[model samples]
Target: MSGHSKWATIKHKKGAADAKRGQMFTKIIKEMTIAARMGGGDVEANPRLRTAVLKARAANMPKDNIERAIKKGTGELEGVNYVEMSYEGYAPGGVAILINCLTDNKNRTAADVRSMLSKSGGNLGETGSVSYLFQRKGLVTYDAEKYTEDQILERALEAGAEDVATSGDSIEVTTTPDDFESVLTGLEAAGLEHDSAEIAMIPDTYITLDNDGTRKVLRLVEHLEEHDDVQEVYTNLDIPDDYDPDAE
Candidate 1:
């Protein structure tokens, strides 16, 4: 269930996204609204809503704003009706792409995505074209400085996680999507804290790219990520360890 994207890619995206708090909030709010609408407004009863609310709190979103989003989702308050959508494509260097979106206008979103992909030297693929390259799984990340690999593995296995791996100063735990929240909560309740948790599309394998190929693929990913309707983008890029995207 571990994601195949490079550590450099993750670092680069996180750094950029953190600088755009408003955009980040918009994405989170959309997820919350959709989750509540699909599973009801009660967080305790809706695992998707529980995860969305947890992310909102982690981002320091206002309590009132969270409540209002839930109300809107429950139809107690008026709000935009967003339909969940996904697109599969291949970037430069054959990097598989999975884009999750929440959109009120599918035609516009599709057109924009297709245009961006074509401009970036990629193609918007038909259904199942690129999706077969990835699997849906849940991921939980922890601070490695606070726990040894052995310790994380021990705790994670006991909590029903399928696998654990070390990525620099962080430890990642992978679990079945259905057991993700329970495993995460169990670990937290047992004194193991996680930095972030999410259900994601993880690639079974990765493809290494040269500097030029990497740059092109990264640019395409950045463009797709910036789309207002895009919720998340998954890829199978494995960047070299020494490369610094921040330096660019």
Candidate 2:
């Protein structure tokens, strides 16, 4: 498992996502709309839409809001047309970064991302520059304290999961994109709860950084994630278990 996955688990445990519920809703809604537009409105028939709906449900988004977003995407209601864009970049310590965005204006998004990178000791890379370091996979994480590794491994492997690993307090289950939903359902049936689940860009390797360098890279990721258009940010940074993100 990537340290980034553990960092996300830490954030979830800290209620960072809950603290920004409105912002989180906004991002999920955008994802749902785009997924519906690209695929179809039927969640059962559309894998992307189904994933988006699962994310919205995880956030406790209102059912009505989810329906409305899907309607907009299916053209049943008016909605902003968003273009999907991906930006490759490098964070501090030369850690590769991949940013996925949904934006109405490409020019504005590109400029904003470039400026953020330049100001944060990073620089945007040409297409495919840093993207090659990542592989798209479905990642499902659980609290290690709540579930034993053996329990998760048994259920995950039985459900077609590719790999299962424990990092710090997180138990991460990796699956192919096609098997993601089925694995989640199987886990649920087995009464295994998940902390966070998503189709993420997993790095082939990680760059372990010292405390100070880790903070610098984390700060840069935080800044990028704060942007309205930036949906997901992936990095090869290996966050140390003892590094306190809130420390000064």
Candidate 3:
């Protein structure tokens, strides 16, 4: 969990950078559209859509834009038909990688992803190759300042969370995928709001990296993330606790 926490911190920092560059909305809108298309647009009835809506709100996306994106997804208005695809691969030092993408043209996205991986000293693998190293779990994170470890554990455990870990400045609560929505509801009822809540790929084990190894892995992830269609990137490289690229 400590390893996961370190990556989470890095991801949040990177997300802030993306938001400033006007890239955040594009990704959020893609999520909204796909969620709406898969499930009905009624957020109350669609758990995925509800999650995406919350993300959009957190990002401070305009309400009108979210609605329009949902409408487009539901075919109430014209929009591109995006499909979800996943690619599994390996980064340098044998670190496993999994990428989630939503795109209208699968071929273009695949070619671009392959090119990026090769350029970054990684290579694409067949489906299920790297995915076997990860488990899909629901992760809900809160700032440590918001609650004590005991407090979070008691409430989150009673709320159906499977595990709770406090590392660095954040506390992460994990739940079975099926119990995620219920646990989230229970947490909200307890007057708590999460810093981040979503389904994530949790690696069973991590390969700790030195400064050079960390640089290689992070560079690969950044390139993968910068692609227009890639929604999420997961890697098993555990950054060294003392390594803070931003502080460099």
Candidate 4:
């Protein structure tokens, strides 16, 4: 779980460059649109949309862009219809991975994903091939700089959180997907701030890798994340502290 948190922090830092790429904004917009379309346009009633909006705001996406995306999703404006897709596979060291995507062209997206997997010593698998290794949960992180471990645990647990752990500078809060919104609201009401709150696939266990293996796994992940159709990549590969994927 700590490894996952560290990876997320790394991703957030990399989001600066990603935000400059229009494709990143497009992906976030697609997520917002779909979340609104699935539920209602009201963020208050739609937790997924709320989360998407939060992420967009964190990315510094413009207010007008956010509003327009919401309107398009609600059919008040034109928008591309995107379908959700997931590809499961194994990377180096037998690390299981699941790539989530939203794409207008399923055939192209699948082909591109499969090709990337094959190029990186992996093979795409049928649905459910790797999903069994994970459990859907709401994973929220609070910065320890702003809140103590005790404070985080107290507020989160009081709001029906399942577990809370302090790892380095972060306090990880885990809950059932259904309890995500309420738990977030609880933290907000208590004046507790969070670094990230989202629905995630928490793997049952992890496979640690050495320098070479971690490099190979990260290369595979970076390739997948660079794909325009890919929304997020979930994996059980744990990179060691000595191995820094971000180091120049």
> Which candidate leads in TM-score?
2
Model 4 over residues 88-124: C-alpha lDDT tens digits? 9898888999999999999999999999989888888
Please, what is the whole-model Cα lDDT of each candidate in the order they appear? Answer: 0.82, 0.85, 0.82, 0.81
lDDT of 4 at 156: 82
Query: lDDT ranking from best to worst?
Result: 2, 3, 1, 4
Clashes of each: 0, 0, 0, 0
Candidate 3 RMSD computed on C-alpha atoms after optimal superposition onto the true structure = 2.5
- Cα TM-score of candidate 2: 0.93
Better of 2 and 4 by lDDT: 2
Q: Residue by residue across 1-248, what tens digits does model 3's lDDT show? A: 22344545555544423423357688889999999999989998998898788778877789999999999989999999999999999898889999999999999999999998898888999988989888898888888887887888889989998888875677888888889888988998999878888888988888877777777788878877778898889887776658766554
What lDDT tens digits, residue by residue, belong to model 1 across residues 65-168?
89999999999999999999999888988888888899999999999988988888888888999888887888888777898878888888888998888776
Model 3 scores a C-alpha lDDT of: 0.82
TM for every model, in the order presented, reads 0.91, 0.93, 0.90, 0.87
State the displacement of the C-alpha of residue 4, model 3, in Å, after optimal TM-score superposition: 7.6
Query: What's model 2's lDDT at 80?
Result: 98
